[model samples]
Target chain A: MYEAYWRGMGDRCSLVISGSEVMSYLGGNPGGACWFLEPELEKSIRRIHHLVGNAAAQAEDGGHVVVGTGSTQLLQAALYALCPPDQPEPTSVVCAAPYYSCYKEIAELLQSKLYKWEGDAHNFNKDGPFIEIVTSPNNPDGLIREPVVNRPNGKLIYDLAYYWPHHTPITHKADYDIMLFTFSKCTGHAGSRIGWAIVKDKEVAAKMTKFMEVTTIGVSRESQLRAAKLLGIICDDCQAFSTNTKSQNFFDDSKRLLTERWDKLHEVVKRSETFSLAKFPKDYCLFSDRFYETHPAFAWLISNNKVKDCASLLRGHKILTRSGNRFGADATYVRVSMLGREEEFNLFLERLSTIKIGICNGIAHIN
Target chain B: MYEAYWRGMGDRCSLVISGSEVMSYLGGNPGGACWFLEPELEKSIRRIHHLVGNAAAQAEDGGHVVVGTGSTQLLQAALYALCPPDQPEPTSVVCAAPYYSCYKEIAELLQSKLYKWEGDAHNFNKDGPFIEIVTSPNNPDGLIREPVVNRPNGKLIYDLAYYWPHHTPITHKADYDIMLFTFSKCTGHAGSRIGWAIVKDKEVAAKMTKFMEVTTIGVSRESQLRAAKLLGIICDDCQAFSTNTKSQNFFDDSKRLLTERWDKLHEVVKRSETFSLAKFPKDYCLFSDRFYETHPAFAWLISNNKVKDCASLLRGHKILTRSGNRFGADATYVRVSMLGREEEFNLFLERLSTIKIGICNGIAHIN
Candidate 1:
């Protein structure tokens, strides 16, 4: 859907990688030698981590960063590192209800005896070693979440994929033991397939690097270099435009556009009796030093009427959405992607506004 | 080691990826719909396979090709697909002795209950389902190999990373259920981290795609596009330089240089009584339709006498080589990479030739 949008934009989000940018297989060594990440990517990650006041900035030594093909790969790496192979029983891995579908699938599909996907984190009460995946500013619902499975043996993997300034409040320097960030949501460069993690423990960092070594050897150096270059541009722009919200940095511009789209979407949702949307309260942002509106990557839509499968209803309206069932929730809730091109979003709004819900005995029904 | 060599070559091997190369994420689709793989990459792969008469060249319908981050990930994917998770016992994965060290390490490190690293293929006589990894023009030994354990339940994975024109004679179109290839070994773009597989079975291909879906989602579009462009250049050059022995294509130039280096290394080894090297005979070529000599990526060096651990001995002489133990081989052998920069190789040769070997009673000692 966004392909046509990007094609129309003519290199708006894409980046050019120079011929000589890639010349070595070793990006950064596993032992915090800066060899696990491409040098420029490492530098950019450090700069951005500092600018965002996220986990890396809070560390005494900037923490150890592990670069991956994407946050999904990092997610897998985190799981691989935390779980030992010889666990007596498969270590239960869980995420909260309305979680990212990929987590459940990846955990189950990799299917190690050391770990098993055991559904919602809220339901798990297992005493043995377990892993809880925490997706903050959650994928579908756009809610800030904390680990609910507060067990002593439970480890938390905070996926900060959408914690960028544009998506949520800066809040604080998010220092944590393990955290993941991606260029996809932050810079809208999903095609690059680059993501990174900031780990306080060197052992965990080394283990994550080992995971990468066996999986893809390492992420693409070209993608890493391209991400580095783009991050540099964004940081430089932010510096120049720090005083003004109308400045041309990526977050400023992306947020403004998202704000308008969200308003339009809200208006459309309000007019419909069949569907409702998740509400995110304004939060105090450290970067802006003020309350900021939410700009989520997706709209978690709930059926307020007889629409049992919101996704199927949306499909009938010619506006495709991912079913809440994919996220281990009921079919009444669906996730609508908010990260597409401007035209794609506009079309989604147009189709959604025109959607006619079915009525039975004066009750609103599926569209 | 090769970093300075490439830095010295400047743009001789480097590739330029245009800004517009990665405007979309939908490469060819998993169902062979041309949605998951970049169009150019798919085309270039098809062309190269056809030109070289390699794996896909002999396919009945051009077979299914799955692109990965590198063959390492594909290696994992293949293992995931071929082995059922519910198998009562873990399937043993074996490569020949003196194999690529990463194979065993990756198999063990991933540690899925479905598969276990079972040392050398020669030692595996397991009754149940197993995977035999055959690296033709094998990693360290440069010996063409077949599955020794040809059990009905045994699966064979052909890693043809070195079967290209530069490394070895393209003997025939390799039609196999699973075959692996990489741009790193072929085009010297290790930084790209892109590799692919030609799988005859659709079910297996789908499984591989599923693995990517849960891992990185897909390879970098920029890397894929870059690989496609480079492959196009190589294939085109191969076409134009097909008949000319003095042709200046990449493979031609690379092979010419490798031939010279191999000859020089052989000369150096001839002067020493303590070392011996693997020898390859001329083979009939299907790509060029003529006999061609070998130019392996790694040199298999055996310590004939005086040095029990050849890699350790080389390290003492200030030269680095992979120990034979890493490949489940005896300590008398070592694997030396041949693709390093010109200066690095020269230095390695100088150090290796001047190394003093211990002698017993005026005779070269076996220890």
Candidate 2:
């Protein structure tokens, strides 16, 4: 987990050297009375100011709220600060089924009872007396669910992790009570470990900030500065280019690769009558409709071993993919991220064909 | 605050750019679901493994803990995990007076009642019935108290922020339940916003970890990796470089610089003869002695002149310093951080001497 943070932040080479210097200074030299002088800290903070815009702007605009440490740390702070230790326990958290696995883990960790609302690929009603987590363009399946924005009963916490690729360019319009975004998914910088929250209420923001103060002291000043710098460049590029060029390119690449693989997978499933597949939503940014159509049977096949589950299939072919079970889906439904290069996608498709044919022949021979 | 973290890690220009690139990819990109991909996460985690040391070793030895965003986060987590929510009230925290200002803030923030034990610099005792905070070479005054290896009646939470610089070498031998360390103070990497606590008790560590899991999800994976890398380098250097050369050189520079400033300040006080000075413990690190001797009159001068405090001195001389009152010390005692190159230091000394004489004369004239 720690390493991922460094990588995500783009600290590849110097981390060891810097760590060594710190250990040496602390453990060996022991300079009197002035070891607390943090020269680098001042510099890093100054640099981040440029990236995130004026710190004052963040306070005033209710945006650019860079988090401390991991987004999880902030999440915990939000729960603690908003829920109040003294108040009656929160009724429950309403989470979309097949949501990010950690949402449940975090809720459970906070001792908040979770209420899962299963929904189709299109939309999920946000109604209940609980905190609602609307993860747009859901994970594993990559289907975007337009929020039921008018639901007034529960507080809304939007995890727009995959929303960038699937939804229209409406990030500016997302005026939620609290919205979470991370650096890992969007930019392929999984190691930077930076995240932010766009929060509306001042009281809630203050509580969250205080909670952050108690929890992490603040996010890594270094990470924030770096994130701010990168974000600045991105924003500039986005503004200067005719369209949201970077995002469009990303979407195009993702779609082309995903569609190519999905078609191949569909052909294989059709050929192998014994094996089944899960269908995908028509407007989905990932997986195809053909897979979703046969989802029930596919689920049974995976459970009964008529065909190998996603993890096994991928592992067997030295290909790595996420198991559907982690996302509240059947074991048979595996999410094959199309973020890979073209050759890698081709290889995956080839492997899927071979694996399905082999599984069918093996079953027939046994019969 | 955010920028300081990166600077603390000692990241150079090129690495900063690359780090920014990674940040953009992970954070600013569209779809933002990249964090969910385990492969990317694994790559980051693997790097951190090398930086922090064998994860296996950390698990086995249980001492090699990675830091989160800031020590405060870990502290909050500890409180949350250890303190029962069902309890009627928050836990009571006992702290030594003139301790780190944040200790009190954290306790209060947690809704815990704080019990402060004021201590005389010359003669102090360490017996309490609360979670005692023993800051070795304490803040504000730089006094290193004896260790409490066995707390028969209460719990001990030690803040070793200044522990590294005061002694000949940093020693992790002050057997306590939880020991806090920060890179900002120790490594001059305040901006990194990374801090960790070494908890001897497994239960405490587990609870803290669980709390952390929910809060920030984990510290920025990127920052941790960078920290681990930096620490690893320092460790390697400590092994390779003999203490005689590197250690001596390091301390000699700091001692020479600090002693010269201290002597100069003492000479100024002696010449002025307007206020009496207090004596400090031989092992004390902060400039508390200087303040104790000279501050009563300084306070009178400030009050009479309607100058708010020492921080206002910046307006007069373009010199920045912290107000001592912030550290639970006399309001008149302003903390002048010794930061500057030699020439700058000389200029500061000259300005300080002039200010001292001018202030004394003005007081006398007014009287």
Candidate 3:
């Protein structure tokens, strides 16, 4: 769908793998600290934690790090860690409405009796062990979330996929008990498939590692090696990424691109009078100490009473969007991705503006 | 444990990853054929299948190929595909008495209601739905195995991890319903952690893919890319990895190394009067169309009645081996890895010779 946009970017985010890497496994070597993970990757992860002042890293109680294929794997590992095999009934996994859609599917797919998907955490009335997944800068809507229901046995999983400085402002050192972060959004290396979790408890981390061992025997050591190198580069460039006019850093380019797309969409929605968007405040970044513009991975757009299924409404105009129902939201809402390259984002804006022009001309096109 | 031995072999298996791969997450690009897999990888897998007439690949009954993180993950996936959630009870999964040790533990770890580890496929008489795991070129004891249970409703899972030409004689095309292979044994890239399954059933392949998607999402695309390139290189070099008369091809090198070590151990056991090795017969290879010597991934060694545990018996003489009890065999037997580099094999030979001298001197150290 974004092929033209990607072509226009033209090596802006292009990658080239060397022949040597193509020729060798270069992972899971006897020299590494463990059979599955590279020691350097672990060190780089530690370095990045300190550099970002991640809450878990800065907490009085230190956290253990476990790398995974991606945050999704880590999420499954977390669920595995939380639920023991001997439980009489499957533990409930609850997420708020407008939650990331994969939560329910991942839980139910295994048909694992250890845990079962029980919908919106707020309505979970059962008195038992349950897991609550909160994605800060949540996908689809891009809202910061907190645990709504407090239970003695409830375990909170903080998915910080979009909490990076480029995607959102670094408000404070985030020190959560179970937090997840991925290299994809932070450095735009989604193809690498590497993510890490910071856990406050030791046993949970060990169980998570055991799950990885019997699954894939752990993450790709080559991927981890590459991740380590790239992470070092990301850390080295972060401070000067958005500053220094001479620097062309990933964070700077990504933030500038997403902010422009978000603003353009906001203008188009306002002009259309047929759609609206939830307001995102310009918050002060604790690290940068400046008011940072809102640049979400996706824009959560709502129909202005004219359309029922806003996703289908957008589809009629040749623009595809994810329906709100996927996120357990009402039919009036839709999510349009803003992470596309300039050409695609601009095309979406153009189509959106044409809708506005049609509305002004008394052409009510909803059928 | 074998650090000194590994160092003695120098750069025989050293791997070097390059700088370009470090900069990018280079797989499943938008231009790639699919989001989860690279097109070249799928092609390479097919190419290797034809190059080595693996039974599942050559059979008149066409099969589908699914790449996995590793063969272990594929094993679990097969179990997941076989046991439906609606089943009244967990299906029983059984392997032979001296099966791969991991089969039982990995099955029981999840404590999945879908399947339970039931020992020995032959003894499983009350089974409603059962999976029979048959490991060809079985680990711990290097021998080709066949399914013992011929029940109508039984599903067979063939683990062909050591069926490659280097490890065993490719006597005929194997057309099993399901066969598993890995790059680790074929190309000596164990660290790559990539494996493929050839399945005769479409529904089974789809279920395996679903398991991957919900687990690690899929195999590491970067690893897949690397495996494809490496396999291509291996295939290209098969006719002439070593051009000179003094040098050897991978098959020649690996077979010669294992055979020499096997003969040395055979000589040592005869002299020691304290242990014995199962006789492995020489076989004819269909691929090479020549009589090939027996060369296995491991040597199954059995201590005399005087010893209670052969693993600990080896450990006493500064050698460590896996206990046969792990593979559901008696403690008197043990598994010695023969796949290590030449230096390690030489060290093992030296230690085995010493056991003979110890017996001759009436120093029966084993209890």
Error of 2 at A244 (Å): 14
List of chain B TM-scores, one per candidate: 0.90, 0.63, 0.86
lDDT of all the models against the reference? 0.79, 0.46, 0.73
* Best-performing candidate as measured by lDDT: 1
lDDT of 3 by residue, B1-367 (tens): 1223223334543434433332233344333222355556666777766766666563345787777777888898889888887888888899987888889878976667788899877677874888999998888688878889888778999999888776777887788877888877776656567888888887887788778777766677667777777666555555454355553355555566666777788888888777888887778887666786657788888877546677877888878898989988888888888766667777887887777423435445543
Give DockQ for candidates 1 onward, in order: 0.51, 0.21, 0.31
| Candidate 2: tens digits of C-alpha lDDT, residues B203-237 | 67666766655555445555555555554444444
Candidate 1 lDDT over residue span A1-367, tens digit each: 2233234334444565434456468755444523558777877888887886755543366478889999999988898899887777887899999999998888877567768899988888778988888888898888988989887888989999999888888887777788999988777778889999988888888889878877787889888877887787677767878876555666666777777878889999999655788778998988767798778989988877646777877888789899999999999899998877778888998888887677688555544
Q: What docking grade does candidate 2 earn?
A: incorrect
Off by over 4 Å in 1: A1-21, A28-34, A58-61, A243-247, A358-367, B1-24, B28-34, B58-60, B243-247, B359-367
Winner by TM-score between candidate 3 and candidate 1: 1
Q: What are the per-model C-alpha RMSD values against the true structure?
A: 3.3, 10.9, 4.9
lDDT tens per residue, model 3, A1-367 = 2233223334433434433332233343444323355666767777776776555553344777788888888898899999978888898999988887778878887677899999887788898888999888888788777887688888999999888766777777788878998866666556567888888887888888777777777777556766787677656666565566675455556677677777778888888777889887778776555788557788888877646677776787888898888888877788887866567778888887776412334434563
